[model samples]
Target: MKATEVLADAYERIAEVVHDAVEGLSAEELNARIDPKANSITWLVWHLTRVQDDHVAEASGLERVWTAQDWFTRFALPLPAAATGYGHTPRQVGTVLVESGELLLGYFDAVHEQSTGFIRGLTATDLERVVDAGWDPPVTLGVRLVSVLADDLQHAGQAAFVRGALQRR
Candidate 1:
């Protein structure tokens, strides 16, 4: 399969994992922190989605679904519009609470859809284009996309583990 198609499939699988992680969990369960320093399921889901939205939008030169669709307003988070949960302290992680699993899933779904669309429109040449210059070796679109996918998958797994912990509790 082509590079874009591979990315689309990977993203779709990540979306499924994310959905399952939060599925049927209450806000209380999602917001539950097993340890004082651990990130909550709500925060994990939100952060993962936010990172995907931010990175993909930057690569695509499109507005993030968060601001484009006013998800920040819906979330009513205390942080600024630019917060993507990177480098969040324990205190900052605790602040990410949602009313319900549906709300988190809604944002995830929207962001995933936008990301999938962007991936679908990408060609081999587009994937080969350099998108970041901070690193010694500038990042390519494909590398950036893979990085986002890896982060999202890790967070989604963490969320699922949190859900399982809550269930056993």
Candidate 2:
């Protein structure tokens, strides 16, 4: 398989996991926190989607799906347009309130489409191109894509765990 195909598959798995985590969850459940300091399922999913949208857009030199698609306004979140839930405090996490799973899922689906499109268009040479220079080893497109996959998958798993915990309660 092509390298980009592999990456696209990984991203597709994230979308599946996210769907599993949020499916059938009530708005209250999505916003419920197992612990006051822990992130709610809603927050986790939203954060992961935002992070993916931000990183992939940057790597692809395209506008973030969040902004390009007006997801921030659709979400009507309390934060600024650029907020991605990274470094969000417990209080900040609590601010991610959505009325329905569809809202989160809709945004995620849009982002996943955009992410896969960017990945699909990438060439082997494109993957080798540097996207960020802040690190000791400059971050290449491939490295950044892997980083995003790792981060999104971690959050998706966390959301699944939270859903299980909520189910048990």
Candidate 3:
């Protein structure tokens, strides 16, 4: 498989894990913040979904989905000026309790669909193009894609921990 294809597959795998972890959680369970330092499952899901949306927009050279819609507001988090950072803390804002699992699932599903679609359209030459964030060193699209996929996977593992914690409670 090509580089972009691998990234898409990686995202799908992570999504499946996260999806399973949140499957049986009620609203309260989804928002359970066992450790303040670590984000709850709700926060992890929102943050990861936003990243996927932002990355797809960046890769396609289009406007970010979050900017077009009140995604942060919908999640009841403080909307950042741009998609540069995490949208909001689900645990702090208590929006997760207000949002049903179905709604959150729909948002995540949309992010995944858009990201996969963008990745599938990328050529190897496109992946080689560099994105200059101007903070650190410039990173190629392929590298950023891999990093984002890895981040999502890490958060999925965290989500599993959140689920286990909820089950125990």
Q: Which stretches of candidate 1 lie over 4 Å from their true place?
A: none
For model 3, where is the 10-residue window of minimal lDDT?
Answer: 89-98
Tell me the whole-model lDDT of each prediction, alpha carbons only.
0.95, 0.94, 0.72
User: Largest lDDT belongs to which candidate?
Assistant: 1
Model 3 stretches astray by more than 4 angstroms:
81-98, 133-137
lDDT per residue, candidate 1, 1-169, as tens digits? 9989999999999999999999898788889999999999999999999999999999899999999999999999999999999999999999999999999999999999999998999999998899998886999999999999999999999988988888898
TM-score of 2: 0.98
- lDDT tens string, model 3, 1-169? 8876777788889779879977877877787788665577877776677777777677678666665655555655544445433545444434334356776777788778778878888889988788756636688888888878888888888889888877887
Q: Which stretches of candidate 2 lie over 4 Å from their true place?
A: none
lDDT of 2 by residue, 1-169 (tens): 9998999999999999999999998999999999999999999999999999999888887899898888889999989999999899989999999999999999999999989988998888999999999998999999999999999999999999999999999
Model 1, C-alpha of 70: deviation from truth (Å)? 0.6
Question: Number of backbone collisions per candidate, in order?
Answer: 0, 0, 0
Error of 3 at 50 (Å): 1.2
